[model samples]
Target: MVAGTVSGTAEWSRPRATHAEVTVGFGTDDTTVQVRSVTTTVANRTELTLANALVDTRLQFLTAGEADDLSVAADGRTRTYDRTVTVTVTLYAGDQDTETVAADVPVEIVVTNEPGNSEESGGSNAGAT
Candidate 1:
């Protein structure tokens, strides 16, 4: 998460994309509790965790490097993966005076290896269909 991006009285829902590779936020309104930020604490795909730059779910396609790192074979230079992630989310109260509550949220990660869809390209291997 950015230094000053998520530290303040949020007038509206502010989504913070942090190490979790998901938007974690804390905000509120008059009705039900609102969700702002979601941080993935654990992921099956460890390589795409905090050490990585790409956010979970947000990027539904794996770059060549990512596939190589995951050792996920590319079928016809294309492939897709589905994984689960454990995340922490914040629930905000309608009354700003009330302290924001933290909640647990589950996240699903899906990615398709599309050619020329990532930042860089290099790992080009063939896999059986």
Candidate 2:
């Protein structure tokens, strides 16, 4: 995540990723998240842009067989799993030709299973009829 500030400000504010292209790459798939391309905007803040960008790239690295293997079910309900993926984010300055910074970042994603409401069970529910 890119953060910046002008300083000398009382209240802190979240830095915006402006004037740059965020490129996420996983294996052979690569996708660029533009500043203006956002899934949702709340109070002028972009939501899920970075997250969606990362997921899109990660999906390319998975094959049909690999995806099927990763899916699992427990107690007749699918369970979510966490996977750590290595990705590279390239930051450009003004233009793609001008590469200002690049880094390999590890992204952890929670892969959700099929839609189902799961009931919580444990010590308290052990003896409940």
Candidate 3:
């Protein structure tokens, strides 16, 4: 695929009352993807963000302690000492786009810090021992 900042909105073809799966990858740290919450069953449109909806995996080789020293950008605010997380979204399921009718759905990704480590240094000071 392409490697760059993933922004903007993409459309997916998902059916009604169905769930879609998404996976995300982070940098060379213990960062991970998480879905805080989701609003999937009420409106025809589903809204997802860092606060809700996330990748379905975690980071290895990165210690749980070190992960506590992560940060994510959200709503023009810098979230420090947060969970390094990523997000993936399934716009639709099948084919929401047809020559006859077309529908474009949108999803949001919000990065934030994870809560757990209450006394660890916010990392960011990697040098040497």
Q: Pick the candidate with the highest lDDT.
A: 3
lDDT of 1 by residue, 1-129 (tens): 101122212121332222232334322232222223343332222222322222332322233554344443454354333332222332222322222223333333333444333335655434322
Ranking of all predicted structures according to TM-score, beginning with the best and ending with the worst: 2, 3, 1
Put down candidate 2 lDDT per residue, 1-129, tens digits, no spaces: 121111110111232323333443332125432222212122222222345443333234344565454554442344443333332333332343222233344443334434444366422221100
**Taking the tens digit of each residue's C-alpha lDDT, what string does model 3 give over 1-129?**
112232333243333424444444444245333323232221234433322333322224234454444434232344322223344454433434211112222222233433333357755432111
The alpha-carbon lDDT assigned to residue 119 of candidate 2 equals: 68
- Model 2 lDDT, residue 97, Cα: 29
List RMSD in Å for every model shown.
15.2, 12.8, 12.6
What do the candidate models score in CA lDDT, each in turn?
0.30, 0.32, 0.33
Ranking by lDDT: 3, 2, 1
Instruction: Superpose all Cα atoms of candidate 1 onto the true structure and report the RMSD in Å to 1 decimal.
Output: 15.2
